[model samples]
Target: MRVLDRPTFDGWLWLDGYQLNKKGDAVTRRELFVQQAGLRKVSTPAPVPRRGGRQVGSRPSGQPPLVRRDRG
Candidate 1:
């Protein structure tokens, strides 16, 4: 679905009243389209943010963060 307008002004786009977003790994719009629907693009957002909030690498305050180190 294409976002004709951002009435809500959130990061999410209106998938013609459904919704379309690529947030994290639970499941994405592209995955859903690949499984059942077809993917297409009319006009996408002009500038997808270079750094998402967490991508900035700053941990939340007052929280002891335990991170997992991935093996290459």
Candidate 2:
């Protein structure tokens, strides 16, 4: 992602990037609104990992993934 504009006074940031679709079949340009404090500046962009096969940095086998339940 690239910073499209300076951060707002309230700490919101505007970003532009090409993101993969949910099915990972397509890429589209998108604008994102995110908190500036949640972002970290990286000296270099990391390589995009290939999809499928064994999951990288994932939980051990046989362990169920954690799910967040929202209390409405």
Candidate 3:
């Protein structure tokens, strides 16, 4: 599965079609290859903003807005 050249537009090269290589097969093989390769689409989990009734915008001291410095 080598991309011979860059796409005409920039985004993501969605694997929605089949491709032929050095072999002589000409049949569309996208689904077959994806299934064989155990590849599937997945959804990413959303970030959990706050927990235990803690406000995401303020600290427990009830002072000014808390700055989110480190996300690491």
Candidate 4:
């Protein structure tokens, strides 16, 4: 039987939801198969849809907040 090799870290990527760390230059078909076998057997929840609304602690939709002038 052919043995599979473990992944080695090469780079990292940051995104809104998750941070992905790429291992090695390119992922081969054999490596993919091995990776799938090594992956944890766990179920994940489906992504939730976004609702139209302003996020909390964010600036208001239109006009900017009042700017204060300093007097010397």
Candidate 5:
């Protein structure tokens, strides 16, 4: 598991390929801190999606919102 990004919270590492823990099995930083463990940090780059990589319900950057008018 390559480090895709730093932990949103300290002591937690996020990998490039997996995004679940949806099982809610992850313990908090208070429970366990593994900063100095076998983990190593490299100046590696984040993974980029091959396609446009737009997320659902996400608007494009810098575009104005649509204006709507109601006719009576």
Candidate 6:
């Protein structure tokens, strides 16, 4: 997620995000509204380097993987 604009006087913020597919390519653009005080920074793991001609464990082309959603 990226901050698209400066925070407003009411502490509301606008953000931009990309929805990536299995190939790490951006498939959709998303806009988000959030509160400045409610945001937290998270540490993400480094990306794994490709080992061969293609990424390891990646599915074949033209096949979309099923996405599972968990209710918190």
* Top lDDT hit: 6
The TM-score values for the models, in the order shown, are 0.18, 0.41, 0.19, 0.20, 0.20, 0.52
Spell out the clash pairs found in candidate 1: none
**Candidate-wise lDDT, in order:** 0.46, 0.74, 0.47, 0.41, 0.51, 0.78
Tens digits of per-residue lDDT for model 3, 1-72: 433343434433434445544443446756222222355457844544443566556576757775668777
Task: Give the per-residue lDDT of model 6 (tens digit) for 1-72.
Answer: 887866566888888998876656689999988888999889975665544675655778799975678999
User: 1-72, model 4: which lDDT tens digit per residue?
Assistant: 233343444332221223322422223333233333344556754545445666655677696866668999
lDDT of 5 at 59: 67
Worst 10 residues of 1 by lDDT: 28-37
> Clashes in candidate 6: how many?
0
Candidate 3: Cα lDDT at 53: 67
What range of 10 consecutive residues in model 2 has the weakest lDDT sum? 44-53
Greater-TM-score candidate between 2 and 6: 6
What lDDT does model 5 reach? 0.51
Model 3: CA > 4 A from native: 1-36, 50-72
The sequence of per-residue lDDT tens digits that candidate 5 reaches over residues 8-28 is 566565544433243433333
Clashing pairs in 4: none
Candidate 3 residue-wise lDDT at 29: 52
Q: After superposition, how far is residue 28 of candidate 1 from its true place, in Å?
A: 38
Considering only N, C-alpha and C atoms within 3 Å, which residue pairs clash in candidate 2?
A: none
Which candidate model has the greater TM-score, 1 or 2?
2
Q: Decide which is better by TM-score, 3 or 4.
A: 4
Worst 10 residues of 6 by lDDT: 48-57
Candidate 4 deviation (Cα RMSD) = 13.8
Residues 11-61, model 1: lDDT tens digits:
444443334355322333431112113444577456444455674556788
Query: How many clashes in each candidate?
Result: 0, 0, 0, 0, 0, 0
